[model samples]
Target: MFSLATWNVNSVRMRLEHLLRWLKLRAPNVVCLQETKATDQEFPYTEINEAGYYVVHAGGKGRNGVAILSDKEPREVTIGFPDVDDQEAKERIIAATIEGVRVLSIYIPNGGSVGSDYFLYKLEFIYRLREYLDSYFDPDQDLLALCGDFNVAPEKIDVYDPELLAGHICFHERERTAIKLLKEWGLVDTYRALHPDEKGAFTWWDYQFGAFKANRGMRLDHIWVSRKLAQKLKKAIIDREPRGWKKPSDHAPVIAYFEL
Candidate 1:
């Protein structure tokens, strides 16, 4: 069995202790982290290495960042889209081939507001992701998993209150459509695949207004797998315990297990 987990830690440095504790508790075979909010220079490589995983990361200061941690060294690693020149966007994506499976840690931009330039960029990022897959992988053949904070809830069931949240930043129709197009390109939402009708299963909750206590949250984080890789899926879930811990990140970790 191989276990993979994705988390948007908000700020890695701030939550390093929690991360270390969870690492020991879960012991996932691979971990995909997003929103590390630390530049490569500031990343705590030594601490993470001491926890027993080799990490590959690309990041910027106090903003978007992504990383992949695995027990075994990756055969190959890529920091970003080969053709995309935007450094910030580059910092949001990182890929590594571990144990013959290609894994990607992605932090899709959380468009601040609907119809804003940043929102358009968020949609464009999804489009570029499709292009990236077209150029580098085959859904029918590749064993690949795309994991991290997507920042968009793909379905109504993914959000706490579908009607109330309609057109909201993360639940907007445009964002859902964009994510659908990416899924059409050959990715399966692993958690949804395993729990098609599950409701209120969210990975992110706003820190304000007692959102977590009210169970008002959205499933913005995910583990998407290609058809070939999806066939190996055994279990997928949102680990809410960490989010309940003291001073936790607004986002919880999503974990998936597979029979490899």
Candidate 2:
């Protein structure tokens, strides 16, 4: 059995203490981190290397970074999509192969607002991701698990108040359509597959207006498995306790267990 977790740390430097504490407790076999908000030069590679894991990171200046950490050193590591055509290489995706399984960490763009340029970029990012996945669709290659802060609430149940957030970027129709297109490409939401009827569970809470205290949150973080590995899924859950810690990130970690 292997346990994998995905978290949007918000800022790796600011949350290092919280991460160390969580790592000491849970000790997941693999961790996919998003929104690191630190450049490659700024990442504390030596510190993480001493934590008994191998790390693969990709990040740009102040936003949108992704990384993968593995208990056993990965055999291969690739940062960003090769098909991105140089124009979209802002460091948002990273993939590594550990014990034969392919783990991908992605930090999808958070569309700033509806019908804005940032929103268009977000959609284009998804399109690029689709192209990347299409290049590796062979089932015989390796089992794949894709995860991170997708910045998307997939369904109404994913948010506390759907109607109140009708046109919001995370819950808007265009974003949902883009996500649907990806799902149609043979990826399964491992968490939702395991808990088909569960509700009121969320992975992100706003830092403003006491959102966490009120339990008003959105399920923005996610774990997705290829159809080949979905059958091996054992469990998936959101660790909300981390969000309650002092100076915690607005996002919490989502864990998934699989029988390898």
Candidate 3:
């Protein structure tokens, strides 16, 4: 049984304790973290080492960072899109091979509003991710898992109130379509594939207005597995305990188990 988890920590420096505690409790073999918001110089390498995981990270000083942690040392670590010099996306993506599996930590941008520049960039980023996969890997043969805070809710069932949130930034049809195209590239949404009809199984909630208490959230975080890895998938879940913890990030951790 190999367990892998993905979470948007919001800020690694601010939520270090929570991460340490969760790591001890859950004991996942590999972890992919997004929104670490710490540059290489400021990353808590020593502390993470003490916690018993080898980590590789990329990011800026204040925003859009991604990291992967494994109990064993990771190899073939890659940062940003391969063969593409995308500065804005530099810190938002990271990948490494751990225990014979290629895992990616991605922090997809949250578009501010419809038809905005950021929104367009968000769409472009998703397409570029597909291209990246096409150029580097074959989903039919590779043992790959892509995990992160995707920022887009792929289906109506993923949100608490579909009618109310319709056309919202994360729940928009365009965003859903983009995610669909990505999935068509030979990836499976692990949780949805397992719990096909589950509703309101969200991973992110607003930090305001008691959204977490009310369970008014969106399933923005995901663990997408390639076809070969998907065949080994035994379980997938959204662990909401961390979100209820004091000083928690708005996003919860998503965990997947495989009979590897």
Query: Clashes per prediction?
Result: 0, 0, 0
* Predictions: Cα RMSD each: 0.8, 1.4, 0.8
Candidate 2 weakest lDDT stretch, 10 residues: 82-91
Scored by Cα lDDT, where does model 1 land?
0.93
- Ranked candidates (lDDT, high to low): 3, 1, 2
Pairs in steric clash, model 1: none
Pairs of colliding residues, candidate 2: none
- In the range 1-260, model 2's lDDT, one tens digit per residue, is 89999999989999988987898889999999998888889886787778777888888886778888888997678877774554334477888888767998988888897999989989888887887788876433458988999999999989999999888989998999998888777888988998877778899989999899887999989999888888788999999989999999899999999998
Query: Each model's TM-score, in the order given?
Result: 0.98, 0.96, 0.98
Model 3 agreement with the true structure over 1-260: per-residue lDDT tens digits: 99999999999999999999999999999999999989988899999889999999998966889999999999999999988898868899999999899999999999899889999999999999999888888999999999999999998899999999899899888988998999898999999999999987999999999999999999999999999999999999899999999999999999999998
Model 3 spans with C-alpha error above 4 angstroms: none
User: What's the lDDT for all of these models?
Assistant: 0.93, 0.86, 0.94
Of models 2 and 3, which has the larger TM-score? 3
